[model samples]
Target: MSADQLLDALDPDQREVARALTGPVCVLAGAGTGKTRAITHRIAYGVRTGAYTPTAVLAVTFTARAAGEMRTRLRELDVVGVQARTFHAAALRQLSYFWPKVIGGAPSRILEHKAPVVAEAAARLGLGVDRLSVRDLSSEIEWAKVSLVAPGDYAVAAAAIDRPPPAGYDRTTVARLMEQYEQAKEGRNVIDFEDVLLYLGRILQERRDIAETVRSQYRHFVVDEYQDVSPLQQWLLDQWLGGRTELCVVGDPNQTIYSFTGATPHHLLTFSTTHPGATVVRLVRDYRSTPQVVDLANRMLSRTPAQRRREGGIELIAQRPAGPPVGFTAYGDDEAEAAGIAGRIRRLVAAGTPAREIAVLYRTNAQSAAFEQSLAEAGIGYLVRGGDRFFARREVRDAILLLRGAARARAEEPMVEAVRSVLSSSGWSPDPPSARGAVRERWEALQALVALADDLAAARGGTTLVDLVTELDERAAAQHAPTVDGVTLASLHAAKGLEWDAVFLAGLSEGLMPISLAETDAAVAEERRLLYVGVTRAREHLELSFARARNPGGRAGRKRTRFLDGIWPEEGSGRRRPGAVRGSVLTGEHDPALFEALREWRSRVAAETDKPAWTVLVDATLEAIAELKPASVSELSRVQGIGPAKIDRYGATVLAIVAAHR
Candidate 1:
């Protein structure tokens, strides 16, 4: 494609980004705003117009997958020789080249897992070496290293930020463990992932000749997801630039959700102040989601605290047509929530929406168990994002071996039947196990293979076991095991940079959404941003739900997340609330006349007591009273949100109103 053709594909905002190929360009890209397209076209246009040499440009992103995608896009544009790499990848390449000259041989083997080393360090310090402690210690050490805090300064730094120590240790002990961890790595002659950047930054600072050579080789830079840049990454980027600024950064402040991993959006937000003459462009036209989805996302973020809100943030304007109004639901318990979502998914699949285009996202990994069990029981194929790979499971491996042996023996039955027969010997059953543990997990994995076999046979008529074996081998080799026909189950953080046709945000209760650990205002703001991320992941259908209790027959004490205060409609208005089911009395099935009468009575009682009407009885309680038509104060006292104190104050009036309605 020609340079003009590249410009032709971009919108006006993207065109501005593509044309501003000079130094210090900032693109304030909103979610689903085509930031990748803008940045790639900018690079391609620069190369096609003879303004940049392909070899001199370096494009950096956060992940290898994203970097590979950029390279593929540039190659498709008929441009090549540009280096697209993660920060660590680029740093490690330079470190490998300069290591022998600067210090020693082969730069130390990279440490793949920090848990064992952390455990050892904790043991030496006489601290507990349990799995969770080791994991938390590893995380804290990484945070300190990336935030540029040294072992001696860790305790003070941690206290300043109010960072609690791991369960078994104090801040001082954590600092000691940090020292021991470094000593352990040195003793092993190895380095962790963060050390790659740390050592490379030191080398570039000390060795000006090497730095100049690197600077000469890569004169221009483009950074994607710049909002996630940590202080250490920014320091390394400064070293790479060596005071020369030929850089363009693309990021969305609202999607800055990795603060726990030492990431911050301060650098992205302060780019203009740092680069006085920079050209700043905002890309807010969202081509990914429908207008309804975009509207919900916008409203969610509008409640962000002014101090934490992005200074120049742009609201997304949906480019797609209107979609269904987002759904809000409440269930009796976790089981009900999961089963309800699964049933809805089955209906959608039967309605022709591909199962692969649906997702169930929650706040934590532990929350996936209920959904997994429900989906498996419903016979819906689902792949848990960031969970164990299907091919890596032992049952799956054993099943594949069984299938391969059966295929070599020339099984004569049909593909699905033969596969099922083979798997039945390995403990595969038509019905899922009643228990929920390793037994259930193994069953689910084998059942996935059965589903795969059925899919293959349907896609290719009259296939044999041999063809199934070949498909399994190919998929295992590619590490892509049967996710094409499965619904996605992911955490909100894992679902970043991904979208689906339908999204169900489950477990939106107070403690889960804001998370019990979110103590500070800033932390709560980030949690809200996380829900915003979840909301925007839908293209057409969106449903947000919560369960009142953790288990059936448990106390229903949970409330909806406070973040949805005014956004979620009031009860009895033909709309859904936190604990109210649609088409139920709490929604609009109750007599409107009685509900209105109850509201008026509550208002009068509130005026007499000089308290708010909600203090007397909220709309949801009134709707419940109207629906139940309680004949006595005892019946009125049984309704939800009506405690003994409330009954003493207004139970008589409420019962009287219910009697009048009856």
Candidate 2:
């Protein structure tokens, strides 16, 4: 209830961050150093001490999920009035509020379906841009917009960044496409994602009234992951601050991985230079990853030359106990690599690690195919993060948008019926196309809508269509990094700000980790940092694996990534033998028999209820049940993360498993 009660929960360094109530405070919060906890507690502490009201504090984060988590944490701290928003969310909110009065009666519609629109534009220009190329072009446009480059200046901008167009395309042609894309969107009266910030920045710069209003409303500001702040995003932040110095920004430059999307750590690295009187704090202790994993991350970053420029370089001292030694394994090919990873994941799950707590991280999205196939073959459920966003699918998005529009109009219709009507209007059918592929995928997505309607109806007990639509919007915003129960298959970039109990870094070979696309020295260094990010995602177990051949018909000789030269096992009478895997990844002191029995019971319960094993009981809870050898239902209730609901449901089964094991 007291400020000190919350402050005492943090480490001494973290406690200082929580107590700093005024001025420009910059925290170089390294991975898993409880950065969110520190920032949340700081706001709570200020509110508790009457230094600032909750409404006076504005907490900004890079992602909607992060903002949502911050809001949840603040609420838990009993400080519920703070405004936590992503840059786009906050800007759009203010822009939406002011646009009606300043510009017109209504704000410009945001361009949601950019890829298809861009593809249509390309078709009009008689250019056959494939899906991949369309996605790349969309990215290029986003980069230019965030960089504040005009369509006419896009070619020069691309050249300045030493970035050429995608293969088989020229810069001038791409520039023309970008122009046409803008024209098409303008024709439709829609503004793309980047315009959210651009519009806000323009309004704040031109209109003093709106700026003053926002500045007055939010007197104190805290920004998480300041390293990823784009130039335009930084401009928006400055407008919100309006020369006021009560700003607390936290980020680690080593984790700056979004440079390709116009995000740079420059803003974070130069914060103190801009605000000379800023109080800087460095958090070096890593509480998320084990010593072995932290050591691997440090070793990878230490090899990079530019790491020193980012303030105190990443010297992450692992505060956790020494975990298993880092394991490096070599595979004959991608198939073998995937199989190896799946086998290990299965072993970890069988050893009492929840499937959701294990992750397989790779360099590219394309690399997920083999792993997905392997996991499916191993009967292990896994969720891919990048490029597989369910809500981002075109048909699903169209259906949701239609429902949202109808809901906003306050249509007197049931939400489920509204969903059905929207899907039908969108030309989605109950029966999937006889043929497989895109049509089938769309059909499946629409079917999922029906299922979601039923589930929401059951959960909300006959909620209004408008409320359901609002729920959809909230879910979409907070779904950036949704925690689903499965083996996490994510690209290294997507794996940032996330941690796992056991992580398998696959396709660690040279052309893969640094990917042949990293042409420049800066790009190569970023690639190394990406590796560092992936390594640090592992908390207890870290396994780095590579393959000699990526595909069956690919080249014969495949070398490990140049970044891994020092950390990876060496070949031919070196420190570690080539093609040799190091350390047992499935090491734990818990009784293996009891653990397996608990897992068997969990699987059975999960199947009976059609839920994830973790939903019945997480691996940690199961491990506790096994290790503590709970003799009865009452004893099982004492395990952490197990509550009255779990005790009422699975406690008896868990206790029986323990007794049977004994």
Q: Which predicted model would earn the best TM-score?
A: 1
Candidate 1 yields a Cα-based lDDT of: 0.82
Worst 10 residues of 1 by lDDT: 574-583
Best by lDDT: 1
TM-scores, one per candidate: 0.74, 0.71
Off by over 4 Å in 2: 123-126, 303-312, 389-485, 550-556, 572-662
- Cα lDDT tens digits, model 2, 1-662, are 79779888888888889888997998988888889989999999999999998888888898889999999998898898899999888888888998887889778888886788889789989998655467767877787888788889978878887776652478898888888998898888889889888888888888998888888899999999999988888888887888889999999988888887889888888888999988988787788986557656766765332334345455666677555657788787777788988898999999999999999998866566567667766778778886675556666677788877877775777777777777787656666544222344455567656655666676666677777777667655544443457898898988988988999999888876897667789989889889988988889988888889745445659888888764565464232322122221122345667976776776677567654344465444554555567686656666655789878877777777778878
Q: Give the Å error, residue 81, model 1.
A: 0.9
Error of 1 at 274 (Å): 1.3
What C-alpha lDDT values do all the predictions have?
Answer: 0.82, 0.76
Return the clash pairs for model 1, or none.
none
